[model samples]
Target: MAVVRPVRGDRVRVYDLQVQGTSNFFAGQVLVHNCLIVDDPHKDRADAESEASRRALHDWYSSTALKRLQPDRNAVVGIQTRWHPDDFAGRRLAEEGRLEEGGRWKVVHLPAVADAKFGADPLGRAPGDPLPHPKIPTRDRKALKAWWADMKRTSIVRDWHSLAQGDPQPAEGALVSEELLRLLRDSATKVEPQKIAVAVDPSGGGRDVAGVVGGFLGDDKRVWITHDVSAVMSSADWSTAACRLAYEANAAIIYVEANYGRDMCSLAIRTSWETLQRDGEIPENVLMPAIDLVTAKQGKLLRAEPVAQQMVQDRVRLRGLFVDLEREWSTWMSTDPDSPGRIDASCILTYGLIPEANKGAIVHAPLPQAPVSGGRGPSQVAGAYGRRIGK
Candidate 1:
């Protein structure tokens, strides 16, 4: 053992020491070992929420920290509170499955209150039971309940779920539920649809992926989502994709969100349709689906609420599984900085199919009808297009 004393100086020099057999040393009163320990890698809530920050942390762990570990003797451990879905804890869980599912890491999740939705609580507490605290007496149930109630009352829903519940997303805030979607899934073959539509949410040259989704109003009066081909693409590519989906679905109309570039958005679809016809992608005999420009007069959340309600009421069904689109719908939060493109397209598709869902949030205007050929009007063309595909 050695006696240590502090020395006063203008500038202090630091040195690293290697322990003999134990490979461990004492700093002040705490034991320092040769294992990697990451404690709250994110500086704050803002950093946790930033994608760049999360990437930087993950990069350092993968590129630098892991390399320093001793193959047999060292281990890695991360301790953090849930901040965002892409936070370190979340990224790890996503990359490597959860422990129960055979992940490499062992997770000990303790929420402020027990929520069965997350998983079984280690403390054996039932749902709604407050976590036991050493500072508070064990017998004080009333005090613990009051404390948790106050916390929930003061904190926002997202924060309460992330910080208190150890869950980044709460079902209360999501636009749709994966469970409900799964339950509504239809396994039967496609049936005749009264009307079909393709909806587009343009990227407007931003980082967002353009959203192109197709659905049909079935004889049962339910909106059935049949296609989702959202992707990061150029203007021409997305417009072409939207037009192609419309043609394949025999959609009577194509609805496009004109929030970013109103005239330009409609123009892109029209140009793509015309080009497809010229290139023989669409038959010359089949008239192009009518293009309707939808200008959003309300916030994204406000416009989406009615559609979400429609789903809850069993008015919306999935013809098949759309994994990526469903993920966006289930995990997207109202507080997220960027609006998810898939969800935007879905809202447009739903509102277009079920006009009653609009509720004044959107104003629709049809583009000038393509010159009718052979005495076929827009209505007659639409009727023809509405016929079931492959019938």
Candidate 2:
């Protein structure tokens, strides 16, 4: 706990409220674990060994990598780390499943970036790790090397830990290249949304940025991103902002992650829609669109991989400039839980666009609202957003 001196000289206060003679946590009782991926044959044999080696090896990236390593243990592990070394959270999850005697413990390493669609690598590997130079364009190679050269001296955390090792935090690396982003962008006039959806990843309740992204199945058989209404708003404001994005997109469905407050988010979005209707914003014919609550079963990186591929394959296009959202996509490696709000929104949007993937996941409202008319431009919706939604 005594890590560094505070800047503002504000002392940390601690008060233990445990009743007298009540304690569960032990002191210095290290529980050695022989962990592996769920199905690692080598680890499976190792688990049967009477004196199994305490050492375990795996990279921080995806769980699929560990599946190749056969394992047998009562407890499975999945570590979400920015580095190779064990973090507090990883240890805590392990501790929860720690056995006093008989239960075999297996911890899986999960290396992920906030925006799987963007970043250094799946394992967060740098360019020059195993190669003198990667196959990047000459300009990009030079830029990367130059950035690294400057960053090594300037950066507190260098590539040795990230390049030679695993970790995305501290360095705060970029995921997507300029070419990739430019390639995904299209002329606003050329792209038109046929079936739109708004995706929201709320921050529960805080001054954190709420990701609100809208896009639709394009006429070109691609997913076209329309807008990014993400902002660092209060709970009330963000909820309304989310609905505003949905309204502006004329989205048939508003997909909200229920990991936070399912009821709270649902109510907030509905309230915003009702407000817009009261102000005669959307046409009366446009009934309240279906609100679908989603709960993510897979990791963020896994969920985002398909969407990333679509963008890389030129199957995803941006209708307009969303600078900040692009930055979030370009820079976030899944180190922090909530840094890449925009990217999270992208994952939700992509899932909704894929019919098979979205099957049985969405719950429609009984009363279907009228569809949005393409006659009016997004400007009217934007104005309504500014006055009422933001208000």
lDDT winner: 1
Off by over 4 Å in 2: 1-175, 188-192, 279-285, 355-391
Could you tell me the lDDT of residue 370 within candidate 2? 23
Pairs of residues clashing in candidate 1: none
Compared with the true structure, all predictions reach lDDT values of: 0.71, 0.51
- Count clashes in each candidate, considering only residues at least 3 apart in sequence or on different chains: 0, 20
Least well predicted 10-residue stretch by lDDT in candidate 2: 5-14
Candidate maximizing TM-score: 1
Question: Estimated TM-score per prediction?
Answer: 0.57, 0.46
Off by over 4 Å in 1: 1-21, 25-74, 79-172, 203-206, 258-260, 295-297, 360-391
